[model samples]
Target: MTLNAAPRGLYFDDFEIGQEIVTSARTITLTDIVNFACLSGDFNEVHTNFEYCKTTAAGEPIAHGPLVYAVAAGLQYATGVNDGTLLALLQIDGWKMLSSVKHGDTIRLHSRVLEKKESSKGDRGVVTFLRQIIKHDGTTAQEMTAKYLYRRRPKA
Candidate 1:
């Protein structure tokens, strides 16, 4: 967290180990894939061509792995949990693409706080969260651990 930033959302003091947050769902759209493909310059057939994908194990055009990751980040932001309290994303470690996300599959993010460490400087803290992207059918499509810098509670 920045020394001068004000806290408007969940500060480090408000978080506890094992706390969890669930986000609203969003359906993956073909538009999303196309836009992501265009944005990321990933024109791979598995994610862009259904006829070509029909020959793959997933059997159809599957969303790009990174696209689903971006959507998961959006879901977290939509929850308002990080509005102002989060300073920055320090790292994304142990990211795993457990399954494929297809067009029209509704998904939600399930995030659990794994750890919190108050900075030695005392103005900020570090927090790690385990996030899972869960499909409508209750399967996890992807998972990862993200570490973030966050503001501490302001002095009264």
Candidate 2:
């Protein structure tokens, strides 16, 4: 992949099992939650009602878990790691929500390459990453293992 300055794109061969990639941070806003709710049809009270959440362990309205997952995936794309020939996004498995993500809470994502293997077809390779969504306080709120298929760079 052609590397750019801001997005931090990484090519197919640039990733290793333990390499960590950090993305630009974003804060979850009430508007964001409401918009997501409208789009996804998840209007759970805990996610949209402050009064209801006040009595819950979250203690406040929180962002949807799927929204947080989307942000983590967006981080990988925004950081330039998704450049070049991306054959497919294979899967995102083993997702876990470790903490509540509230409105106004800033979050960042970090992905560590967990495995890489050449495809039998030889045109692409599989890359699996351990993705973590962490709050500004460095607490992990979400985690997942995402896998993708990337076309190998043409031999010179």
| Candidate number of the best lDDT | 1
Clashing pairs in 1: none
TM-score of each: 0.94, 0.90
**Candidate 1 per-residue lDDT over residues 1-156, each given as its tens digit:** 658655458998898999999999999999999999999999999999989998999898899999998998899899888988889999999999998999999999999999999999898999999989999999999999999999988898
Q: What is the C-alpha lDDT of each candidate?
A: 0.92, 0.85
lDDT of 1 at 138: 96
What tens-digit string does per-residue lDDT give for candidate 2 at 6-117? 3234556767779998999999999989999999999999988889888999898899999988877787678767765677889989889998999888999988889999
For candidate 1, the per-residue lDDT at 9 reads 82
- Superposed model 2: Cα runs more than 4 Å off: 1-9
lDDT of 2 at 75: 72
lDDT value, residue 18 of candidate 1: 96
